[model samples]
Target: MSSGQGGGQSGGQAGGQGGPGWQADGRRGAQYPGARRRPRYRALSPLREHLREAFWFAPLLTCVGAVLLAGLTDLLDREIFAEASAAQTADTLLSFSSAAKSVVSTVSSAMLTFIGVVFSISLVSLQMAASQFSPRVLRLYVRSRLIKATFATCLATFVYTLLVQLGYDDTSDPARAVSVPIVSTIVALAMVMLSLALFVLYVQATMRLLRVPHVIDRVTRESLQVLQDYRWLAPELGPTPGAVPEGPTLLHEGRGGVLRDVNIRWLIRVARRHDAVLYQVPRIGDFIAPGTPTVVVVGGSAPRPRRITTALNVGVDRTMHQDLSFGFRQLVDIAIRALSPAINDPTTAVQAVDRIHQLLAVLAPVHLGELRHRDKDGAVRLVQPVPGWEATVDLAFTEVRICGAGQPQVTRRLAAALDDLLRITPERRRAPLLLQRALLERAVAESVRDEDNRAFALTPDRQGIG
Candidate 1:
C-alpha cells in the first residue's frame, strides 16, 4: 500500500472518500439529480445497531407513543366533550357507558390474544426457517420492518384501548353521558382495525420463510445491493483489498469479537491527525480476540490502541454491512444444509446455488482487491484488507460443491454458474472460477457411483437439470 501515490485515484469516483463529513461531488453544495448517492451501508453505531436488532425496540417505542396518545384523548374527553351544552349535541353524546366499556374491554383483550398468536406463529416460523434453511435467516425476521410494525401496532392498540377504557364512567347514565369517551373510543377502534390489517400482512410475510426460493431471492438481492454499494465506495477508498498492515501494530484490548466493519471517518481522521497511514489487520468477517493486532501505522506514530479499536467494530456475528462474504456464507450454508442426509432436498440446494451464481456474476466485474483509503489531498491514509477474489469465490462454492457433488441438479447448476461467471469476468479474475471448475469435476468423478451419472453431473445446466 503506497501512502504517497495520488495519481490514478484522483478521477472518476462517485464523490466522497468514504469518510464522515466528506463531500462526494468535490464540493458539498445543493443537491442535484446526479449528486452522489450515499452508499447502501456505512459503519452503524455499535449500540444503535444492536438496539435495532432487538425484538422489543419497535414495540416499546410504539407503546410509549400509545401512552402519549392516550393522554391527548383524556384532554379531549374533558375539554371538548364536557364543554358541550345539552342542546349543542345531546343526541350525539348518547352512547351507553356500558357499551363504551365493552367495546374497549373486548378490543384490548382481543389485541392481547392476537399478539400471543402472532408471537407463537413467529416462533414456529423461526424454528422452521432454522431447520429448513439456515439459522442466520432469523436475523431476517428481526430486521424486518414489517414484523416490527405489526408487533408495534398490536401492542399500541392494546395499550391505547386499555387506557381509553379506564376513562369511561361505570356509574354515568346510559342516555345522559355527555362526557362519553367517544373520541378516544374511535381512535382505539382505528388502531384495532390497523392492527388487524398488519396481522394479515404479518402472516403473509412470515409465511415467506416457508418458501425456500423466496428466501434465496431475498438473500441474493441483499448481497447484490451490498456489492453495488461496496464497489461504489471502494474505488474512492482504496485501490485494492489486498493491502497488508506494514507499520507498528495496534492491538485490541479485553475481549474481541468478529470484525463487523470499521468506522472509516474516524479511522481517516485518526490517521490524518497522526500524519500516518493505517492498515487494518483483519478482513471484515474475521474474528479478533484480546491482544489481536487490529491496525498498524505506517508513517507517523501509531495512535493509542483505544483510538484504533474505537474505529473497529467487533461484534458477536458477521453482518452484511460491509462483509459481502457473509452473504455468500449464508447461501452456502443453506445449500449445504439442503444436501444433508437428513434433509436430502436437492431442489433447495439448487435454488441456493442459483442465488450464489447471481451474486458471483455481479461480483465478477467489480474490483474488490483494492483496500486503500485516501484523504482530500489523495494521499493514502488507510489500507484495509478484504476477501480476495479467490477467497470470495471459495466462500461461495467450496462447501456447496463438496456437499452436493453426488446430486446431479446441484453439480450441474454449479458448473453452469461457474462457467457463466468465467465468461463475463475479465481474464485477470478468471483463475478462481477455472480452478473451482476443475475441483468440481474432480468432486463429481469421486462422488458419483456410476460413469453415466458422473458425466451427467459434470454437464452444465442453468436450470439445474435441463
Candidate 2:
C-alpha cells in the first residue's frame, strides 16, 4: 500500500511539472524540436493606426489645408492687389461693394446649414444601419474617406468664407474697396458650389449604406485588403511544437474591448531581446476583459506589461486591420438579422451568404492559425493566435446556419456556398467543409419538411430553384 501511494505521488509530481508547459485553453507550446526560432517584427505605428480609425483625422487635415490655402490667398491679395496697376485691373474686374457682404454671408450661412444637413443625414443613416444591420457598420461610415472629405470641404468652406467676409469692408474707405480680394471672393463662391455638389454625393453614399449588397461588398473588399496587407501565409518552417518554459503571464489592465490589432513586429523584437517566446491569449476579434491573461511569456524574463499593452490596440469594436473574422461577423450579422422574424428578408440573407462564400473561397487557400514571428537571426520569438481556416469557416456560417433554419432560400444558398467551398478548397481541408455540409443538411432536415428536404438534399441550387 505504501508503494502504491508512492507511485501516486510520483504521478502527481509529474502532472505538476507538466502543468506550466501547457496552456489551459489547449494551445500548443511555443517550443518545438527541429524548429529554429526566427523572430519577426511587423508593427503598425500607433499614430498611424489611431489616424486611420480616428473619425476626425481626415477632417482636421482638411481644415489645416484650408487654413494654409487661406493664408496663401491673403498673401496674394497683399502682393498683387496692393499694386496700383493691379488695383486698376481689379476695378475693371469683378469688385463687390459692402453690399457683397450679404453674398459672402449668405454663402457662409449656407455652408453652415449644409454641414448641419449632411450630419443630420449621416446620423439618420447610421441610426438606421445600427438598428437594421449592426452597430459595427458605423465603423465603415467613420472610416469612409468620402464622408470625411465632404465634411472637411463644407467646414473648410464655411471657415474660409467667414474669414473672407471679415476681410471685406467697403464701408471703411472707398480707396480700399479696390483691394477687396475679389479673387478670394470668387474662390469662396466656387467653394459654395463645391459644397452643394458634395451634398449630392453624400446623399448618394448614404443611400448605398442602406443596400445590403453594397455593404457586404464593401466589407469583403476591406477584409481582402487586410488579408493582402498581412500576407497571411503559413510560416515556411511552421510552428515549433513542444513544452515551453514557464514564465510570467501578463494580464491586461486596460479598458476591455475587442482585441483589434497587435504590433507583431514589436512583440517579436521584445521577445527576441529578452530571449523569450510570447504567446498571445486572445485572437484578434476576441473580447478581452480587464485583468484577463493576455500574453504568456516563456523561456526568459517577461517584458514590461506596458510594452505588451502598447503593442496591442484594443477597441470597443473590431476592425479589418488584423481581424479577418470581423468581416465575416458583420456579414453573418446581416444574414441572421435578415432571417429574423421582424425582418424576414430571406433574399438579403442569401445575398450575404453569397458574399461569405466568396470570402471563404479566398481564405481557403491561405494558411490560418497561430502566426509565428521570426527574428533577424531566424529564431522564432512571438507566437500570436489567429483563426485557422476551420475557425473562420465556422464563424462565417455557423450562426447564420442556425438562425437561418426554416428559411428555404437561406438554407439553399448556404448549401450552395458549402459546395463552392468544397470545390475550391484542397482535399486536406475538405473535411471541415464536408462537416459543415453535414451540419447544414441536418439543420435542413429538422427545419424543413421531408418534401422540401428532398430538394435541398440534392445538388444545391444557387437560386433555391431546385
Candidate 3:
C-alpha cells in the first residue's frame, strides 16, 4: 500500500493532479516534516453506522411496535365487551371458563422454546460460514434482513400472546367471566402460524448464505450500488492540475485500524472552510498502523486536529462504503483459501473468479483516481486518493495468480478473465490487462509441461473447458 502525502501550490492547481503523483512504482517517496499541533476536535460516533448495519435494530423496533399493538387490542377488547348486548356477548365469548388464558400461555411458552431453537440453528450456520469461508462474512449473516425479520416475528408473537393472556378473565361470577379477550386470542393464533412460516423462510435464507454464488452476488450488488451512487466525476468537470510541493503538515494522530470509511462530504466542507487541500493517504480498505499519517493537509491556516480526525471513521474491519477494493478482497480471500493445500478446491476458486470478473467489468469503464471535491464556484476543496485502474486490476488478480500457480484450471480461468477484460476495457486500461496476461503466461510456461502450456496458451477458456 502507498503512504505519504502531497499538496498543490494553488487551489485550482490541486484539481489538475488526476492521480497520486507523489508515489512512484507503487512506493511512497521520502517523508515530509511532522504536522503541527492544533486544538482537539470531537470524533464522530460510529454508533449510527453500527445501528444501520446492525441486525438487532429492526427486531428491537418491531418488538416495541408489537407491544403498542397489544395495548390497543386490550383497549378494544374492554370497550367491545362492555358495550355488547347479551346475544353478542354470548356469540363472541369462549365457552371455557379460563381455557383461553391456558391456551395463550401454552402458545407463548412454545414460541419461547422455538426462539431458542432458531437462535441455535443460526449460530451453527454462522460457525460454518466462519470456518469454511472468511470470518469477514459473519457480518453478512448477522446483518441479514431476513434473519432479523424472522427473529422479530418470533419475538412479536411471544409478546402479543403474553400480553393478550393478561386480559383473560377467570372470575368466579359468570358475568365477570365474559370479559375475556377472545378476539385478541384469535390474532395471537394467526401470529403463531405466521411465525411458523417465517421459520421456514429463515432456514432457506440461511442456507443460501452458505452457498458461494449467493455470497458473491450480494457483495457484488452492494459494490456496484456504491459505484453508481457516487457520481464520481461530473461530465463538465475539467482536467486536474499537477500537485504542488508539500507545505502544510501531515496529520497521522497515531491512530490505526482498518479504514472503514471517510465522510467525503464532511471532508469537502472542512476543506472549503479552511481553504485547504486534503489528500487521504490510504484508500478505504487499507490498514493503517499507529503513528502512520493518514491525511496530508495543504494551504490555508492549519485546521483543528479534531476536524481532520472527525471526518475519518476508522474501525477494526473494512465496510462497503467507498471501499470497492474490500469487496474484491473478500472474494479473493475465498479464492486463495480454496487454492490452499489443505482445501485443494479449484472449483471453488473458479467460482470466485467468475464473480471477480463481474466486478471488474462494472469498474472497467468508470473513472477512478484521486477524487476531487469542489465548492459551488468549482474551486477544489478536498482531494483524496483512490485506487487507479491498474491498482484495482492488480488487486483483483495478483494474489489469485500467485496462489493458483501450477493449477491449470485456476490459471486458465484467470487468463480467460484477463482476455475478456482486455477486449472490453478502454485503451488506457489495457496496459494492466496486458501485464496480467504476460504474468499468467509466464506462470503457465513454468508450471505446466510444454505440451500442456500450448493448450493453456490458446485464447483464454473462460470456463476452463479443456
Candidate 4:
C-alpha cells in the first residue's frame, strides 16, 4: 500500500510494486530511527474514492437528474398540448385527470415510506452482517451497481412524482384535475413502474447480500478482477535480484498510513528524467512513519523527495485495486472471525475457504516477477520489492488453518481446498499447498480427540460433510 489520497486509488499488487518501496529485511544498511512524514500521492483523492464506493453518490445524482427531467417534461407537455391536432388526445387525458393526480400522489408518498422503512431495516441488517462477517464487506456491499440503481430509481421516482403532483390543477374542480399534465403524467407513471420493479430486485439482492456465501463470492470476484489487471512480469520471468543502487535516499514526510497506491509509470518517468535508477524502499501496503527511507536515487541526480513520494498513495484501509493480497487478507479475516471461539461458525469459515481456494488456484499458474520497471530503452529505471509465493501462500492459509484446528468442518473443508489446489496448480507452485496440507493434518490430529471425528476431519471433502 503506497499513498492513498483518493480517486481511482488502487490496492497493492500481489507481487508488483506500486511505485514507492522499502525493505523489511534491513538490507538497506543503516536506518533512520526517528521518522518525519509519509507523503501523499498526487492523483486520486480520498473523497473521490469514497464517492465511487459510497451508496449515497448514485441516489444524489439521480435526484438532481430527476429535478431537471421534471422541468423538461413540463415544457414538452406545453408544446404537445398547444396543437389543434392534439386536442383529441388532450381531452382523453383530461377525462382521466383525477386518476393521474391520485396515481402521482400515491407514488410520491409511498416511495418515501418504502425507502425509509426498507433502508432503515437494511442498515440494521448490514450492521449485523458486518459483525457476523467482516466489516470490510459493508464497503463491498454498497459497491453493487444494482443496489445503487435501485436506490437511484426509487428516489428519482419520488422526486419526479412529487413535482408532477404539484403541477396538477386543483382550483378548477375539487372532484377532478381540469388542467392535467399530459406527457409529464405519463413520465411520472413510467417512473412509478420502474421503481416498483427495482424494489423487487433490490429486495432479492439485499437478501442475497445477507448470506455469507454470496458475500464471499462478491469479494472473490473483486480480487479476481484485481488479479486480472496485472500485466507485470511473473515470478519465473522476472530478472534476478540485484543490490539496491547506492545514491541519495528520499525519506517519507507525511502522516503514516497504509501504502495503498502508486503510479509506477510516474516513478519511471522521474527516474528516466534524472538518468538515475529509482529504487522504492517501501512496498505498497507497508505503513511508513516519517523519516522512513522510501525512494533511493542511484547513478544520477537526486529527484526531489516530494516528486518521489508523490508517486505513492496512502490510505487507512487496503483496497482491491492493485493489491492482490488484500483480497486474501479479507477472506482470511472472515474465516478467522467465523472460527473464533464465541462464533464457532464452521460453515461460514468454509465459505471463506472456498473463495481463498478460488483465488489461489487463479494465482497458481501466474508467473509473478520482480518489481523492476524499465524505460523505453529496456533499462531498469525503477525497482520495488514484492512478496514471493511462499509469503503470499502463508498469508492465505496459515491463520485459518491455526484457528480451524479442532473444528472438523473447517479442517475438512481446508483439506479439500488444499487438495483441489494441488491437483490444478502447476507442479512448481504446489509446494506451499503441500506444506499447508501437512500442517492441517498435524493440527487436526493434535486437536481433535475422538478417532471418528479425527478420521472425518482428515479426509478431503469440498462440502466438509456428506
Model 1, C-alpha of 250: deviation from truth (Å): 0.6
Tell me each candidate's TM-score: 0.89, 0.81, 0.82, 0.80
* Candidate 4 displacement at residue 441 in angstroms: 3.9
lDDT of candidates 1 onward, in order = 0.77, 0.69, 0.70, 0.72
* Candidate 3 residue lDDT tens string, 1-466: 1112221112222222223231112123221122112111122358976875676787788789879988887777666666653555543454542566777899999999998888898899999888777887788987777787888899988888887776667564546554657667777888889899999999999889989788878877877666543322321223433353376655556377877777656776777788887767777777776566666777886676667777778788887766667788888888888898988888888888998998888777665545665554446666666666787889889999988877878887898898888888889669889999888877777777677565664446777556
Off by over 4 Å in 3: 1-45, 85-99, 230-245, 250-255, 453-459
- Candidate 1 lDDT over 11-122, as tens digits, reads 2343332332222322222222442445643466888888878888899999999999998987887665666543475445654445767888899889999999888887
**Candidate numbers, best TM-score first, in rank order:** 1, 3, 2, 4
lDDT of 4 by residue, 216-300 (tens): 8888998876665442222224444556768788998776788877777688788889999887787667888778899888887
The CA lDDT at 416 in model 1 is: 92
Count of backbone collisions within predicted model 2: 17
Winner of 1 and 2 under TM-score: 1
Residue 28, candidate 2: Cα error in Å is 27
- Cα lDDT tens digits for candidate 2, 1-466: 0111110001111121112221111112323232222222244565776776676877788778777776777667656656734446645433444445668788888888888888888788888888888787788777677787788889999888878766664544435553556567677778878877887888898899888789889988987766653342232224334433467899887878888788766677788778888888777878888888888898878888878887887876677777767888888988888888988888888888888888887777654445555554445567766666677878888998899878777777888888888887878788888988889888877777787564654447687544
lDDT of 2 at 427: 88
Give the Cα error of residue 328 in candidate 3, in Å: 1.2
- The segments of candidate 2 whose C-alpha lies over 4 angstroms from its true place after superposition are 1-42, 45-75, 78-81, 85-102, 172-178, 229-233, 236-247, 450-459
Candidate 2: worst-modelled 10 consecutive residues by lDDT = 1-10
